[model samples]
Target: MEGISTLLSYILPGHSRSVTADYQFLQQSWLPTMHFQASLPRLPVPKLEDTCKKYLTTQKTILSPEEFQQTARNVDEFQLKEGPQLHQKLIEIDAENKHTSYISEPWFDMYLSDRRPLPINFNPYMIFYQEKNAAYNSPLVKATNIVISSARFLRALRAGLLEPQIFHMNKKKSDTKLFRVVTRILPSRIATYGAYLFKAFPLDMSQFENLFGTTRIPEIGKDRITKDPNARHVLVMRRGYFYTFDILNEDGSIRSPHEIASCINSILNDPREPNLCPIGILTTTERNQWAQNRRHLVDIGNADVFRKIDTATFLLILDDDLVSEDFPVLVRHFLHSDGCNRWFDKSFSLIITGKGWSGINFEHSWGDGVAVLRFCQDMKIDVSMRPHFHPEEQAHLPSSSPDVEKLDFKIDDVVMESVNRALKEYKHWTLERLTTKHLLHNIFNKKQCKNAGVSPDAIMQLSFQLALYKLEKRAVATYESCSTSAFKHGRTETVRSFTEQTKALCKAIVERGTSNVNNKEYKKMMIECSKTHAMLTKEAAMGQGFDRHLFMLKRIWQKYYDGEPPAIFKDPAFTKLNENILSTSTLNASVVMGGGFGPVVEHGYGIGYMIDDTDLSIRLAVASYKHNRDASEYIASLISAFEDIERILLSE
Candidate 1:
């Protein structure tokens, strides 16, 4: 009997090697989600001299000649003095710790120690493209699908059946059934070799563990992340009230879609007029003040309720307002809601508005966009392909179905007063201080970029440089995030997009109009700028960038040294470069409509863009404190810059 069973396994359609050749089948089959982690390479530490040279090179593009000279001297002095010792220490630390990257601890520290509120200052948002079928876009239908699909994702992840995330350079060869079968049988220690042989690379999966069942717990000075792997329920918020109900059954199976929808319908239909002392509003307050208020809640016996919230699989927000068709208004709703119905501390909150527009508002400290975006892509695919309920389907449940429990927080006059203050502050912060503008450029996109023999991302970065240079009359420090997830325990590295090559091109276009510009010479310069930007992006992605290395070294100086930082750290140019006046990031996934974050500095702009086959989408946000910085005007400049660059590319 055993022999027959084994023989049948080889002959069955699902288990046959030939059947596995279908990429879709391979994805659905069992593949250890973290099998590649053991063999993933460690992130390298760059040389001290290389870092010093790059630092000076970046400063030269942004500073005046005299300022650049002083900064160069300071960098040279630091290179000769304390730099070597710090670099050596960092190397030794890396050598001793083979399990993680050098930047992991310090990166976590940098995010956790920040005292600003999470909504605008830290948390970022991404909206899902509307569903193709209008029925699936119903609030109840969408919410039910999200819950069901999320549970499937969580279950697959825990059971080790989820496909490992891989980058296939040549999909025709590497993304085949033969490659999957071969890699599956190999031991975890050397499985990556099989992938490398096929020119495929598996990314670090360490961050996936924190994607679910995690919360950013606010403390006085520094917050910490806490997770409960055993939590089977999800926290739900509606009209500023908190509730929880189990989404997973006792046998470890996901609840039926009808049952889940019934539970959500109960919460949505609850007659509780919006909570006057909404506890969630406190999460939007400054971190330290929230910490104090949290302590008071604990002192007054709300610890059990807090525990339920902090340990849930994730949070789902049911918004009472319908989203506006205006792009900027839609962005504002998802980026940071009215601040009353959001618990921004959750690893992420899946928000569904009345009209059924959905997106994610996530806490930034736990992880970067790589993990969150992957989750979003998978959820979107699942919800679209295998939807469990229809638009007009009514939710029905048996009497045995469990009821959702509302979290009744014990509050007093002090807590109510804090809630009032928090509401006022949140409204002022979101409405008055931070503003957003959206641009959808339909002129040209990826095909045009490639036909001109340049990367689409490089073109976008160059457009940003030209736009800012046109608006501000000078180049400022810019940041483009490059994921370092190809290595173990990696987060992100800064790709400084503003280069001398880009600056020169922007100068020519601004000073001499496109009609007067020399097309041949300008095209050569544009290509050179694109090439340079590509090199910077590659270096940053491979963890060989100078920014993280220098950042870590300066942190060591402050923590270990006695009095003041080195001369290089004190330079005005150094401070200005780190300010990141033009912070930019790009996510070009079909599942995402648009995304944005608030400015990093008071007078800066946060730009999130996506480039498709025929158009470009941009979301720009800025703080009101800088009277000179207008998001709308900057967007206008970006549009003009794209037109100017297109002419340079298309010229004979």
Candidate 2:
């Protein structure tokens, strides 16, 4: 019964759900947030032959004929030999572990086993759009409101009062109060069935548990996640100093907003100069090195302070720098910062700039963008609708009970040396190699794509293919993240956007240039490419994609077999297909100004984009080591590609 609902979602495309619209109705739901967990289906594994076929198809667009033939032979041999046995073993293991998805444990191991530093390699940032009212943009006021609103969200979630996250295909019918009332009366086991009857699909809420009071603890080999849900305080960092104070009272109710504001203000105004050796910078170093330094800190009697910082409800960083109007510069700030004021190990840091511009820089090991996006969306709406502090209001002076306490670590010479080394490495790594460029193209957007009868996401992805072709005259392996949250304990799937249709479209555009030799042909190719991309996206979302299945089979071969692995795993095409030269993701929300991450590969580009009514926002980052890559040229190509796409769409 694995992926039954997911398969149905694919079969009945009209019944699929979207999460773009605001979910204010969550505040009015009658059912518990986890009511649909038990009924959610497990992520399914695709058949071995289907996995091999899909693998060959993906390689065809990027590989030469000779290379493709060699790879096909290897794949055929593996499919007939080791692939079946390994896949069968995986299925058996998955059957024994009926409580979770097949990919969950290996996925966790994949992230935890990485020895790279977390900043550019793992952590990503999402910035919120500025408030409409100028007064609400005050740092103190915004920080206060965020604290209060976040506490409300936490309380609702812990008490099972937060509405379960569901995708409603027909909001008018499925997202109504009557639907909720009917669903509340159904048994917990059948709650999902009730939702299906209403054409709403509930998402797995397991990741929500780690959205708060969670921190990644660095170890020698692999990092681990630690959560202290009972802790009531929030950790605050400013000018390289750490502070902790309670935000929730004995009754589990949020404290006075004015009090929270005052404590933050005091820390902001504190005259203590920045620490000469800020310990937070150590987290930006290599994981194994950071782990060794952490052990030293514990040996030096800083364990209690470390525990407090780890167990806090969440971290709030009060940055001294004012927000920049330049989009790329602001992205740089939110993404990694100076490394001194950011504790990159926290589950997520709510950062408020001096001018009140704010966003979240999150550690990516525990979860993906879906959970964080929901938190951001809900927080944005809550603060806008029900603000606790006004712009004209002043923070009330703190009384004897809830004063903020600054945490002081007793560090010796060795720790200071480690901090200095870490700072040097971080500065060299971030400041020297990476470059980011942003584009806000106003020529066309989702509305135009829809009016032209094409998938908006496909249009953007096709533009990427065209852009890369124009720049490099080749099609490379590209990655687009597709969420699989419709299943139990779902994470993500790789949507291989470079397809045979996309390659044809790119070749036609590049070869024809501005001539109208094949205008009708171009339009036909565009539509076909969109349809193919849509099919791939749906398959990836339904847990029927081949990437993860093949990955897990290879993992089993490596872990269980002692001798040399299968030939398919050793093929050069396999390595090239996983290189991911153009790594892309889309998160379009009313409140998100834009967001991005660093390039996964040293010479590749990491693109985060959002489609709006009249424009598209793209943030592109690359590691320009030795000036091998040009961010500006790639951005120009993207703009031209988008214009070319628009011309084809509007062609008669």
Candidate 3:
């Protein structure tokens, strides 16, 4: 060790240094000597650096600032000029294939849940299933390559579906990415057995109630209702954006809560008249109630019901009218089917929630079985981003219907009924839930999380803590017991770009997470915020946090739920969000924090996640008086389960 090479000193000095005399003894005692005699003291060391430089042409080629600038400019011009031309031909070819001359029909091939063994797995259980399947009859379902594409993109999407052979390959391939519709593939495989393609069922608006049945939301035991502080619900926006239902006076404050109530009432009176109005008047009783409760959460007594609607999450544009409420079947189809590559919960914000709307008690369906509750959330707004079911559109409902089995209600039926209700909520919740902040931290990171032994995630345990924490929070209700999303993969058609506007506030909150703020890093962040502000002010047509898609969402929400409408929940503005076009994960970390929620944790976007957190000794809590006890118990159950697993290891 004493004869080690000189490089070892710089690489691993492993010494302590002290600026004061307080620790001089320890520092001096441990440090190596400044001078040391070599084992071969008589030998002369070879000058390696000088010899290499002398043998080579010792010339240095360094680009200066001006040279760098000129080089960058030339490169930029080359790319800009050639990029479009290279892509134009492909774009033109695709556009030319459009069915402009053909007559179009609204008939859609609805995919019933399809089951297929895939190369993908979410939980350890799925991995176990894969091992078991390797021994089962997985003939064509084996590692056979298949090619499926959107009807519109038929040309560019062929050459793969050659033949189904005897191949057992679960090896995930990049080529297979385009075929995997994220939500559709995963949810259907887990929920239903295989893929099903059914024709659209036509519905006559006048006789709509007959095709699909309806039922009242049954009650549960009073003691079953939870009041846990950590109870929560999250609305991660998969797509589009959010907007406020009401606007404020020039002075900048809501007149009163009654204004909201009045607006809700007005919208119900006529929900269909699409004018440039706000988004409160067109909601149903359930939505109106939830809106009122939300107002209370945001400084309840200060403004009229409709006077000042919180428009913080307003302004969204959309690719299609898939955000409407009338297209339930289509919206949920791709949500749970592999028709789109998205995490189920991430694709649709109709996630499970322990936190009720703002303050009122309700359920969620996006992830939970709280169909009715999440439905109430969606009913409160106008979602033009989805397909709206008007009388004319209803005519396209399948002229013929499938025979849906009807089973009598039993005690066990309660769970199924809850499931159906949650499904209904999902139709609308998927879209509405996205634009709004999820019910995630409304309670999880609130004061109550401190008391319930809840806590934020540490660096390593971030995702585990986030999902598990949220799970426990919403597990208070039996219906909203459990549900989750999938992580993204580097599929052939992986999500490339995502908007950061949704999470700006959350980042601001994180910037304040630590106590010390007098650092250079903090100053740099301030400069960034200033830049964001400057960019926002330039785009006056769009407000701050104005993503075009999100802004469009805001406008639709304002018109449907905030202002007057032709019909509402009572009047019949109720509809579905994505019927078949499932959206997927689009949360910006910042939005997760600032939407008036709390301490940001993690969502397993691409990590192998497990909810294993110790040191829950830190009791975090949220305060919501009227809470669901069952949901609370479930949240407790999930948290305790993870804790127990960890505790068992500790005991061992």
Candidate 4:
């Protein structure tokens, strides 16, 4: 009989070859930048608790110091600088987050690739990995949205920061590729169509920095808000219920997106439970046949939608364990309801959060992405009543339990067949397909760069190391990788007045025929480009790094900012990008959540949220690999990040 290696060869014809390819790709392509990978074993994660504590130290300091104090001195009620052209109002509110000119050189390279003359035919590939699958309209839409912010509004925004005394608002630019913003939020379009929103406002920094076009907010200890800085109230909102699956276990359930759904399914569909609803129906526990109702299940009916009484909406494709050492994985990702008045109100809209969470938001038209934080917060609605936290519950954070041993099997025909089968047969596939990622299993990888202090490349490298660790059986978390990136808007630093506030690039995309006034800003950048090119050496960029962008945007890129010295970026002919932070959003983190779920079957919303909602939101992401590697501890880390963020904020 042939040896096991021989059988694997047959199962995976490309086995021996992939090992070389994976190494070459890593060593030549990725490792040169981060030498540790080639020479060392998988990079080590700091003791999860310690690393988390470190990350939390900064989190706790975000609003405590001088910057907060300085800004606190003269607080202005968030005044609408521009009168109500409803969409314009959204733009002004949203634009405040952006920092510089929106045009990102790399993204521009991606966009203008075809149009560019000669050898530079844009690779049409992720500069880091294989070209992202062209199948999903997501990338295209993403490109459009990114450009609107990067190219148009990002370049021309006003400068200055607003420390709102009231809301924890996160505004992002809409992809120019999406339906018109006004049309998107229209109750009509929202009622029957897709989510006009995406994984928008979750304190996502890359997109925020790019649109806002500034350096990371200096630590409060290092900066100041203004005189008599008033301690801003920390505002929390539920976004939506996220999901994951798991396998039944001994110590506890080994949940992933799939298993979570299954658990919710069993409890929700139990006829004895009678009326337990899904995540959205009850922002707070009001009605349920059983006390611990498992909401977030699935309803099999055609045109199935989530609702107040529909506990069967959530579904799980994996099993659960009896005792979990950590948070179980989530196989399924969350989606807002398409149900009648009790869910979305037939109008695509964002739910504005406040002291009293809205009760009427679960209706179909009322949803989009905006309500997730609130919806998620609502899931823990019952927690406040029983507010006391056990040590384990207190350890809660947002993380995952990615299975790591599968790489030993090789990218042989066997694995390919399983993945292919996943695409063709997986009934609940929400993402585009599993083919490309399956191939790049050894290639490009990243994680979101939350701290503005870190370099983007460093962030990507860390994510790469994490992926490697998981592939090599050393990862402590479910995330094989994360999406680490930043946005590049125009620029600015002076917050002299409201007129000096940032502009929303989305405005241009939303309202065609924008005045030439905004057009001037782009022209100015064209002029600056000539000099920017002269001064911007690739090495200098590496030095300025992502963190410096936060500061250079203020000191160096001022020309591109809304009210800076006008001629800095201007040229005689073409209008350069007028970048701004407003007018954009991305789903990289949300996509990560989806990936954690093993497969993404469907997604809803692009830019809006639920109205009259809860204060905190919960997300559940699951991963389904060939086996359930005991992962409770790793999954717990993610929950730890969340709690760390929450606790730090509370203690402050």
Scored by lDDT, model 3 comes in at 0.21
Instruction: List, residue by residue over 1-652, the lDDT tens digit for candidate 2.
Output: 1243344335332331211011111242367889999988889888888888988999999999999999999998998889889999999999998888999889988888899999878888888887889789888888888887787778668767678989999899899988888888888787888889999999988999998899999999999989987778999998899998888766565666667788877777788888897999999988899999999999989999999999999999988656566667778888887799989999999989877788889998888888888888988888888787787776354432347988988899999999998888788777877777777767766677788888988988998899899999899989999999998888999999999999998998898875465767888888899999999999999998888998899899888898988889888888899988888888756677878887788778888888765335443343333355677888888889988987887777
Give model 4's TM-score versus the native structure: 0.20
Off by over 4 Å in 3: 1-86, 97-377, 380-523, 526-652
Q: What TM-score would each prediction reach against the true structure?
A: 0.94, 0.94, 0.19, 0.20
Tens digits of per-residue lDDT for model 3, 169-265: 2324311323233212433213111111111111101111111111111111100111211111111111212212322222222222233223222
lDDT of 1 by residue, 234-288 (tens): 9999988999998876645566567688888888778778888889999999899
Which RMSD values do the candidates have, in order?
4.2, 7.2, 33.1, 28.4
How good is model 2 by TM-score?
0.94
Q: RMSD in Å for candidate 1, one decimal?
A: 4.2
Looking at model 4, report the run of 10 residues with the lowest lDDT sum. Answer: 119-128
Q: Which portions of model 4 miss their true places by more than 4 Å? A: 1-370, 378-424, 427-462, 465-652
Q: What is the C-alpha lDDT of each candidate?
A: 0.83, 0.83, 0.21, 0.21
Candidate 3, residue 59: lDDT:
10
Across residues 328-437, which tens digit of lDDT does each residue of candidate 4 receive? 21111112211101121111111211111111112211111222222222222222222122223212322222321110111334334433443233322223221111
In lDDT terms, how accurate is model 1?
0.83
Q: Is candidate 2 or candidate 4 better by lDDT?
A: 2
